[model samples]
Target: MQALPKTRTDGRLPLYARLRDQLASRIANGEWSPGDMIPSENRLAEEYGVALATMRMALKQLVDEGLLERRRGTGTFVKQPAFRADLFRFFHVHDVEDPDGPVIPESRILSRQEVDLPPEVKRAFGDDAGGRCLKLERVRLWAGDPLLFEEIYLRLPDFDGLMSLDPKEMGPLLYPVFLQKFGILISSATDELSFGTATQASAKYLELPANSPVAVIERIARNPVGRIIEYRRVHGRPERFRYRVNLGEQHT
Candidate 1:
């Protein structure tokens, strides 16, 4: 194997930290790709002229961050974020006959307009929030019936040209659009689920009775830098919402 380049030490971070950051950057920049096993600890330690313990610490840091994975018999590999897990955990579409089967809901863009930023929406963006933002009202349909009504907000200028795209062209998911169109990748997201009375718009879009109890989900998506890029509030029929969790050993 070729000699691994010594990690650059700019005098700010410790050697192990520098090594960790270098490895993470390589993965983020696609030097090593998803599912590809990385160099073994002994080989990496020998190449970097670092102690095995130091190299192990660096690799462990990346593993803890979910950027790398270590198998008992297999080698360490790059870890791709599991978007499907989150979708199945939160999305409200499921087949009745085949409970484990996948369902791809149809997307409908009810309206797209530039709207005044609400206080809550502004806070979602943190300092990046401004006076104006784009509001998109949409619905997801399963078998021609609405499953979820969503109100999406995006910071202006970042998503300025998004309003012009046809709804059919947007596909069933929005994260891909952020990547393909705006050069933005959703690195992490937080979803808060609660029960609330359906709003008038939700009632109209979701075809629920007036003031029906609905499952509300507030999803905030951020880029790798932790800058909030999208804020969405989704309302779904409480009966249609199913949440499942697989619990393993808990680490306190």
Candidate 2:
């Protein structure tokens, strides 16, 4: 393996961050490919002439960013690149225009249910699952690899016959199905973004180490009548994905 570039002493950034930046740049330059094992922590420590903890901190940052993946009983490897999505625009994964992007997203249906609504869900739907609600747990993949895990809730009245639809036909997009089946037009939406470590389930789905960092996005889609039609929680691989926002200048 080639030696990592030496760090500059003039910069004020943390040492670990500098190491993380260097590693990322190397990967972008094609020095590392997906599934290729990187040096062990001890080896990196020796190469960088840093303490073990410092090496670990640098690796952890990359793992959180999704650039590197850890396999139990094995070492770290580079990860598959991810698509870049702009936060300011409305997007559905199926409608994405990039041909090189994920064409067929593999999906695993973890659970499906019709049960009494939870308080938070009730607030969003306005009506309890007093009648029924279809709950779906799904993991979405890109290029046949798992990329996201999602939990989606839809009121029963709006999708009375949803169970009859073939899961394979749904792809990674659900909003369009809602529109076709129930005329639930999503007029607007509100989203909240936060950082979190992976849960046991998410770690398994993403094939990542326990406590690996992830990006969490929570969204609520409303219809023209001001009814909350869809509530979704999405867990994304941090390193592979980035959220882009465009800011408009304020008037003087």
Candidate 3:
């Protein structure tokens, strides 16, 4: 097998990023297949003759990008690639709000609780620290078959009656529920999509083969007044969906 490259020290970028880029290229070139276990961090460090931290940084970057999967008891493995969605417009899962969309998505409310916002989530929800929020988790289905597993966090004030609604009563439209109940308008959203491997739980729910590749999408939705109302993370079968985008001309 070809050896991994040596570390670079040009200082223009970190060594980890360089390593990550190289690994990504290798994956893009089909050097690694889905479910293939990757070299351990220690091996990578030794191969590059760098500190463990440096190697971990590189691996974490790949994990964040969904290029790798880290299991608690198992080593890191290659992830399935996902379709890239254009960020210029708002996109929602089919049944979430559009009546014309399919109603195949089902929910299994994992838990509902009011907890102190984690720093990252708090920052995303704006200056409403005093206001609590609801955390909802559900596995989405297509044609009664599992398609994705999603976790959603919503600002409490914007979803006043959240805790009272039964999972089945949520309907196919989440946004409309908020609007009808609280008059909150979902005006815009931002999304970051990348490749990822299915977690054990996710894989089981989706009935995917062990270590199957998946896509992960992180989205933040905001109201017209610039307050974020929803934060969601979705994991889906990469082969089943594609993200489509349209671009406009840039003015000179």
lDDT of every predicted structure (CA atoms): 0.79, 0.68, 0.68
Off by over 4 Å in 2: 1-108, 127-132, 248-252
lDDT of 3 by residue, 7-94 (tens): 3344476677777766665554446655689888888788777789988998898788666889888899876433122221223345
Score residue 222 of candidate 3 by CA lDDT.
63
Candidate 1 CA-lDDT value: 0.79
lDDT of 2 by residue, 1-252 (tens): 435464444477788877776776656444665558998999988887878898899899878866788989999987654333323122234435775554446567887777667666777786444545788888877656667777777877777677777777665566656655554545456778887988888888878899999877777876532457777777777766655568899787
Tell me model 2's lDDT, rounded to 2 decimals: 0.68
Better of 1 and 2 by TM-score: 1
Which residue segments of model 1 deviate by more than 4 Å? 1-63, 67-93, 96-99, 247-252
Largest lDDT belongs to which candidate?
1
**TM-score quality measure for candidate 2:** 0.54
Worst 10-residue lDDT window, candidate 2: 83-92
TM-score of each: 0.71, 0.54, 0.52
lDDT of 1 by residue, 174-205 (tens): 87776667766566788999999999999999
